[model samples]
Target chain A: MASETDYVTLISKDGFSYVVQRSSARISPVLKRMLDPTGAFLEAKDNTCILQDMPGIVLEKVCEYFYYNEKNKDARDVPEMDIPTELCLELLMASDYLDI
Target chain B: MSGRRGGNRIRGPQSALTDFLAANNISAAQIRDDYERRRQQAEQDAADAGEGPSNQTPEQNDDEALAAAAQAEEAEKKTKKRKRTEKDAIDKIKNAKATKKGKGKKKGKKDEEDDEDGDDDADYDDDFGMYKKARPAPGQFEHCDICNKRFTVTPYSKEGPDGGLLCTPCGKELSKDVKKEQKAATKSAGTGRKRRKVESDRLDGIAVGGAKSLSQLCIQKVAQHHDDIEELGDLPPSVLERLSEIFSKKRVMKSKTLPLFLRPDLDSVIVHDAAYLEEEDYRQIFAIVPNVRKLVLSNTCQLKDGAIDYMLERCHDLRHIQLYAANLVSEGMWHRVFREAGGKLECLKLSWLDAAFEDLVVQDMVKYCPKLERLKLKLCRRLGEDAVTSISDLPELKHLSLQISQNVSTPVLVNLVEKRGSGLQTLSLEKFIDADDSVVGAIHDNCIQLSKLRLSENDTVTDAGYTALFTDWDNPPLKFADFNSTRDIDNNNSGGPEDAIGLASSGFRALMEHSGASLRHLHIASCRHIELSAFMDVFNGAQNYPALEYINMSFCNRADTSVVAGIFKSCPALKQLVAFGCFDVQDVVVPRNVALIGVPRAQDAIEQFGIGIGVDEAISRMVEVTT
Candidate 1:
């Protein structure tokens, strides 16, 4: 029930969804295109995007990395974020898809 | 329970197999004893079978067969025992040797520690002892870790990451890696080095009040007092020279300063840098410095035929004229200039003349300028053999440099040398493609007073020619000799035992033997055919070049680290060595007084033994400031 203007819901293949701020989600070009207000797609109307090819775990890590990058965009020394070794490959594939 | 079961079993004759199983273990001695007993039984059985041959039974034959098998088994056991003992003895000897080597290493370590302690107060004399200890044993051999091949380990052997020794191939690879790493580091550092301050930045410092720029203010000031400006004729020559320098530095020397210096009274007007002077300004120069005896224009890109004609008409007292990059002056104008103004010309230097300076001009200059003592014609590509031959007409010419003239052939060079060699002191025929044996022979036969001879980049000259030139020649020992790139063409075209056409073993030896005593500077770079054996032989032991100071042997592929060491050992007064592409020289220890350039590993040697800061250190400091 989150307002469409404030946040966008991103759902993975496993139906696990994440509600991120509209500004933070816009950091990723793919998400920004999907949630564009002028677009005629269902994602733009509903303010929710379902990434059918990405796993839930990978999508969650991608969302976290996007937020981390947004918060530290201008920082010189950003703190290292930990990603599980098993999830690294999946996260890289998902990031490439999202163009982040 | 097993023992009780064995007791309940019926017992029979104690066979050798049963005895072996009951013993629970088998020894070599036991096997030998059993074999001997069986062999003796076989002999008894054979005797019994022979005695009762008529009534021999199957059981008796079987016993005889078993005895024969035991005898064969016994022979095999004896051989195995002998082999085991031999192996055991070898292991014992190896252990003893290992212990001995360990002890020797410990003693060596102790001696090194003692030497280090004693070295605290040691002087230069003790350096020999320390050096001897530091050098690895020459006869020692070690296996290469990469290929597991045994090779003679020299002092120059490279240590792997784990302290293992590498052979020559692997060592070369590692050295290349080090060079690549150093190159990358220096390249990155070079990017951060000090950038030259731009002209705008310099102007920024001079601009005041921010209302008007410095140039605008200067223009206003000059225009306001244009009539009050003093003529250069009223000022002394020193003040005129200083003003010319300031004007040139500010790039305002073209027309503005020309009028100030162009007066009828001045005899000598020398602008230090007149690069911006156009044709009109040059005309004014000739008009103002009418009676000037010496006129030196460093950069005359805009100078034309009209300016030269003006100079020839007005500056008749000019004895010396040096023009650089004066390509605008045409051929006919040059002929006219030489004919009119060449009467008292003593020194003429025309450089970077791309057009109109050819055989006709040289012939005119030779015919007119008889008093010319020094003449240098550089980058005048149209000059032919006829012009070169015309140079022989100058009887007073002591210094001549004809560079980049490809049309001059061997016979003409020889003729020129024969004609003017006696008076020539400094002759540099650099990049003349046809300077061969005849020219070298001509120089040797005639030029006795020659002090400096630079015959660089002439590929047609052979080793025999060089040998003939230096072998027991009566000419005075040269003070400077540059034979760089003489053998480069020979390396590419010809294929034989003496493929390198310029200088070989005997030629190099003769040159060193003849000129080693008085030679001050020698550059034999890229003389690829100069054999290392000849180099070593000439510089071996007490054969020293006392006066030799600077030598560049860059790109001499045969000259390796050993040849460099030999040069250092023989030449005590050497100051600079440039070994740019001599790849065989690795990890060479240069002398404290000598400056070694283009050597990556020499950086370490320079840091250890050099007097001033090394090149890398200076570059890094500059990089730090700029960054």
Candidate 2:
């Protein structure tokens, strides 16, 4: 969806792939470390990383947040982010895990 | 009326009325005669209709206007032969003359208003006839109130003077006018964002301006929605610790949310606030994580004997414990913990114990916890001289911090220092004002392994004593030191004895010379006897302190611009320099990356000279400005 380059593909455990800009995905330290081009991990060569512990629904929301964070990185008084109630626990764990 | 100046005449065409007059062959006499006939006809009709049209209501205007239009429509055939002299044509000429007169005085006092008293919307509508139509919803087409151009209406459309919607350009013009008026109201309110930021940064702490990091924002969001969080699964120990801090800070760490922070893999459980946590909630901590080795619980008002017993029984691997305001835990339970878990305990810090923890329990703690390495006892009112004398028995105490209420004897402190000072890496005995120079002499004599020292809030330690303490001492350079308020506070004798009661010239110079390289943080606030010569001599640009980063010299008088500049010259690594009450530090530019707190006029230099200037450039600018 994002021209397949300058972006990274995140594959959730439930087999859903999200295409997000590498700059947007750089908000997470885990993703930054995983997508390091210099590192020889399989994710670096292929521009794709598998989040084995996350589901597709939570991963989609995480990608949305990554882009949102990138767009308003230097902004102030930003509006509160929209999140679903059912995924609050899983998302908190994901954010903590990814160190978002 | 026609005797106007030629220069004031139309450059192009003045009004539509004049344009029609130039085009028409008829003179003003013809129009006056036509108006007379219409007036007679209207008077005869008014007598027959039993009323006059003058001062009529809007309903009468509508009725009379419709009748005139019908009459003109019927006479259209005959008027065509008379060169368009219908009633509507005469009305057009009259309306154009009125528009010209209104435009000359106040351009665009609305058309309806210019027509005067009884004129209705249909009688004086603009060419587009947009105002007379029903108001449309947002996203529907409407005409601009001023310019009469059609545009789509939106929720943000500005209203005109007569309640019609304004287009985007008119809206912008209105906003600009409003802003100009507001700006005119208060010129001083233009304090730039940078100055406001600097002022906010000086409220006794660091101010990190800018948006929070993404992770920090997410963590705050997680804390905000803590009630909905079912579980915090497999978060790292450090992240979990930070979450616990946030939860406690928000007072959201009740029994319901306590389990989310508990994980068996985390050895450290820090609950910064526990006011709402009862004894069962405290026991739940031990029940969840029996392997917790390091525990820090503050505001532990309800942690009772049962929780302590459970913690002592369950956590066999507990090595460090720091508790604050745990008054509900009795002295018997503290003795039990010390007796049972003493062999593995490596660090213990307790404070605000007013009712229970007494001298005997402290003596027993020293006897029991042999492996204790760090001890901090603050505001424990029951701790007296006996507890003070008994602390020297701990064999492995490398760090000891105490702020007790009682005034212990000088010999007892000296005896304690003589026994345990050599092994102490840091010793903080704050607000112990009764001890004299003998204790300082003892620290200088017996202390060799000390790297951090604080003997602040004392009136008896003279400048000579501090000089002797640091003059030829064998101790290594300390990394942190705080000797604030070590002054003689006599009302009648403001300045101390001629030799200077507190830290003076030679003592300050000697301390800087000894530890200037390794000292990262030095707090000498309220040490008023520290003279300018000592400050200048210590930071005179010849010596370079490579690692000194922070210094607080509040209330140290005579620290003027020269000493401040000299400090920037000497301590190249200094980041935060605080001189709160020193009024003499004026007309100095703050170097880049260093926060100069408590200067009122600092914004003049920081803003005028610009940010991130080199230290030398800033110092030179200060000289230039002063001269």
Candidate 3:
């Protein structure tokens, strides 16, 4: 039911971009503050964010996880979301920085 | 490559520096050999030149000397180059592999490498580097500095004075000695603070006018000064008064401090706790202050017949006498004191009499003390229905507190209320378990001037009685009301449905609706059978208790968080809400102006939002979860 205006664009360091819904993006507190309507940031004005420290591979995994969490948020029995073992430490560090 | 560096000397792969050195074919031994060969060739050249020196002239001798100086300079430059190369090799060995091995293993490897390079003392110069420092070899025996005992030393050995080594036992003992000295210093400092605290506590105990019991104060004073204080006569009158309070609170008012409290000029003497004063002490008080008008004594077990007679004979103008736990005073003594000295007495309070006081004493008091304005009899078990009925005859009585006297029947109580209830302002009948509907009806019919009523711990007074009492009642709204622990008695022997006693739902609603505007303190704790729906309906936003300041509803488990929240919204002037043992009440927000106690989960809600939230917002948040 969401229109295209409800989506935001996130670009990684290597110029890889992903589009996510506003509700899903708000799950991360950092993204929520950036995209807040009361804020004066460029991200809030243009509905776009750029993360300089995150690589394209790690940003792709983070975007996938946001969607996965949104789907299972109200489910009584949720299925586990799989992540590659080598990417765990980097994902943990990135999530800590994002305050998800 | 392994054989070129000798046998198994380097454990891991060679570093870039070692590889470069090996690639250049510059070994330590080869450099040394070149240096020696050059030195020997120089010596041979010098010897051959010297062989022809004897055949030269003076000019040739000077030229030979100049040539020799030039040769010596060249040799010195060669030796310097060789020394620089040797220093570079030693530096590489020390810096490259220092991190790979332990210190002991590295020392062993260095010794082996020194022998291989044929440089016996080269390692001494290498010790000047930052990474390496020479130390005494491990497992070397040394004497302890304190005990002079020889023991094997390790890297963990403690250093003593003058850089001597101490054995393990001596080091432990020395540290323990230092700790003991520090502990003693701290203990002395702590004792100073403790002494100051005790002095302040004693002063605080005096200022509060006996907050602690008399025996506890006595023990504290005795512990402070082990010996008795004998002389207190020179103290000023105000100081004597304070000392009397201290001695009375300490319960040590014996013969020593008896003279301090007595003077002929003083007209009134009040010993707040007279449990320790013996018979002779009472005689002394009477003998000293014969014109004393107001005398109050608590714990009068030591006052016998002779003491009472002496007081009645000597202090004839005594207008007020209050006695507590005066069981030793006989009925004959009471009759005599009332008949003789009860003409001008305006206040008489006797409490905690086991069996000595009876109906005859009450009759004598009512007959003799015609001008009495206040009469209180508390916990006097032997005073029965006749005795309580006789109190209705006092013409000017105003305050009466009859507590825990179970034998006074309902008819006698109704009779007393009918006779003198209009003049009574404060009536405390706490633990009157036998009071029922008739007594409530009589109070409703007559007691219109009541300002404070305490009917706590009465299990027989039912809801029907309370309902009838509050319905269309004409009395003024009570300022203080206590119905705490007034529940139905669950008779286990009769297996039928339990008859609910005490106040019920509609009765409580009527009481609150009648008195809600002026009630300042209301305690209805442990009234379990009051239905939860009735509680919520009565305390909803439609009903307002504007003057209510303090309320206690502990152990009323059915009133959950929503009911408490509704009470908060309804009572505008509420300041304290106590909800102990109400387990279902959780996460209820309290307003900043009010203090909430004993609601366990409300503490977390307060911590989360702090005391800044508005009342309407808190009520709305609390209601959202319940619905």
Candidate 4:
């Protein structure tokens, strides 16, 4: 199960789409719940979360954080995750929704 | 120099300051007197020249000041001489020390006298280590305080150690130290902010100690930027709920940020603080999230009848409504919401309702809301014995959590529990201080499906009553059990009489024996009578509590390290063990996974070393800890 990585597409508001490992995307509880096979959500059926309200620029950072959070979940004294000041507020709301 | 207010940023290197002074045999007082004399001479000479001497005092350093002061006295002769060389001087100043041999041409006047002073012109350049400043005004030519070479002055000149200025070359060298100090100051400021957050998180129980998890750090960042957030896109309700909590705690849930929580597809709109929200904002919540089934708002001081009516009119899927401190909503408006929309409502929790919700309001809730599964009416001032009687009529009420101000007897509560307890999953009756043993007997007989039970703050129920409630009862083991502050309140006898009242040894042991396997969160915060032996026996290595995670045995005075260590031995899944006021506890080494709280004497050592180590290592480190 650990050897194979499932991929999912995250589409942003400005028609920007990012393909990321499914496990990394599941770092967000909202995404995990939405994409759970047992649950009947459109995003799960298509293996995609529309990310309807997020801009592409913000969505890119969200994808980065998904991997960053997953990579450093158990790590200590890690370097601070860099955030662009201009998009901090947007990413903050997104992160709250994602619960990453 | 200990940051003296007037002190320059770049001083001569510390050893250099003393070395130059000692070698020159110069006292600070003597430097000050000589500097004072030069300044006074310049002023007096300016007065004599009337309009001012063309040969200006350049406000030079200690040694140069004396020479400049002497030049000021001979200003009349130099003015005529400067007129002849003015064109050449302008060209020289413009070249800015490029004419390296300008010092040779200028040697006839000042260099002859400066050479007499010897090493006085040799020191004080740390940065450029080339052109030290002699406080020359812009467009003037002063000798570089370091090499004693001539250089033109500008505003960019850096100050030297002996109250002079350094030229550009020396200025660049001095700034390296300033840059390092700036970097260190910013780094410490960042750490200071992080330390404060950790301290507050420790107090809030968000961080269990040690470092915070990565998600916690991200989530906290999200809370801080709440105002800037336009909307949260399709977040899980749990995270949304937590965001609301964090926002409310941070006092950021205002009119501007409230709109971020509302979405058309969302089934719930929870705002933990509506203190800053007006009636219009409440209407916006209903208008935006029309499908909201679970709407929770606290500190709704401005939620009047108009907004409640709007919510009922627009939100057709409204089922669970919990509003706290909605004192502005009248008794009549609550009636309208319950009567009009209560048919679909399954849960209704109204707390801190000081103004309106009376016994009639609860009666209205019981009468209208037929599908109500969970009902909590706490601190509603008018709720009394009659309200309890009214609540007994609800047909499907499974979860009942109430904190009424009135002294309700055992029978009224017993009647409610017996009528509804068979199908009940959660039953919490808080601060019913007048309730006696019969209510426990009634629950023991009727409540078979109870997963959570809290009958707290009543001193009349003895340990025997609690033991009876758990022993041989057909009810499944409770997932949550809170018997906090149930002890007999007596100032005269601190330990209580021999026949221990409230939850004591026998009752507590029975609770663990029954629920220990399934119990996840247990709060016996002030159950003072539960003896040390009972705690030891329950947590002994012979019995393992597989699912138990969080246990609060605060004020259970007899619980020492032995019992605490036994708990560690028994409950492998335990994460946080809070024992506030457990004074006897001492020198207890906690394992990596568990957070030991409120054992005051041992907290510092635990915070330092108790987090992030295995059980075997912790056991090895465990000393003769309070035998």
User: Candidate 1 regions off by >4 Å?
Assistant: A1-100, B1-274, B283-291, B404-406, B488-500, B601-609, B612-627
Docking class of 2: incorrect
Better of 1 and 4 by lDDT: 4
Which CAPRI tier for candidate 4? incorrect
Task: Tell me the lDDT of model 4 at B278.
Answer: 92
Once superposed on the true structure, which residue ranges of model 3 sit more than 4 Å away at CA?
Answer: A1-100, B1-272, B284-294, B404-406, B491-500, B541-546, B566-577, B588-627
**In model 1 chain A, where is the ten-residue run with the lowest total lDDT?**
A73-82
> Which scores greater on lDDT, model 1 or model 2?
2
Q: List model 4 lDDT by residue over B1-627, tens digit each.
A: 122223557755456675566444334545577789989988888788865654443322323333333333334453445546433433333344344334533542454364445333221211112223224567554555555544457788776555466666776777877897798667655685665554455545675544343345555777876767776766667767777888988898888887777778789988888899998898899998999999899888898999988888888888999899999888899898889998999999989988888888888988889999999989988789999999999999888999999788788988988898898999998999988889999999999999999978878899999999999989989999999899988899998877878999999999998998799989998899988889988988779999999899989999987788788888889888888888887777888757777787633532322456776666666754333
DockQ of 2: 0.14
> Which runs of model 2 end up more than 4 angstroms from their true locations?
A1-100, B1-206, B601-610
Q: Backbone clashes in each candidate structure, one number apiece?
A: 0, 1, 0, 11
Ranking by TM-score: 4, 2, 3, 1
lDDT (tens digit, per residue) of candidate 3 on B1-627: 222547656656667766665554444445567789879877876879866534544433333232222232233344445455544543444343335234534344444443444332333233333122212345655667788876566787776754467777887787788898798667655565654443344334221111222223222443234234444333334444555666676676666666667878777677767877888999999999999887878877788888998998899888888888888888888999899998998888889999598889899999999988888888888887888889999998887778747566888888988898888887878787888888888889888878777788888888877878888888888888888988876677422125557776877888887788889998889877777887898788778888888888888777888788888888888867778888888877766556676676532421122154667988887778667
Clashing pairs in 1: none
Q: For each candidate, what's the DockQ?
A: 0.01, 0.14, 0.01, 0.11
lDDT tens digits by residue: candidate 2, B401-460: 998998788888998899999999999988888888899999999999998899888888
Looking at model 3, give its docking quality level.
incorrect
- For model 4, the superposed segments whose C-alpha errors exceed 4 Å read A1-82, A86-99, B1-196, B209-215, B233-237, B602-609, B624-627
Alpha carbon lDDT of residue B172, candidate 2? 88
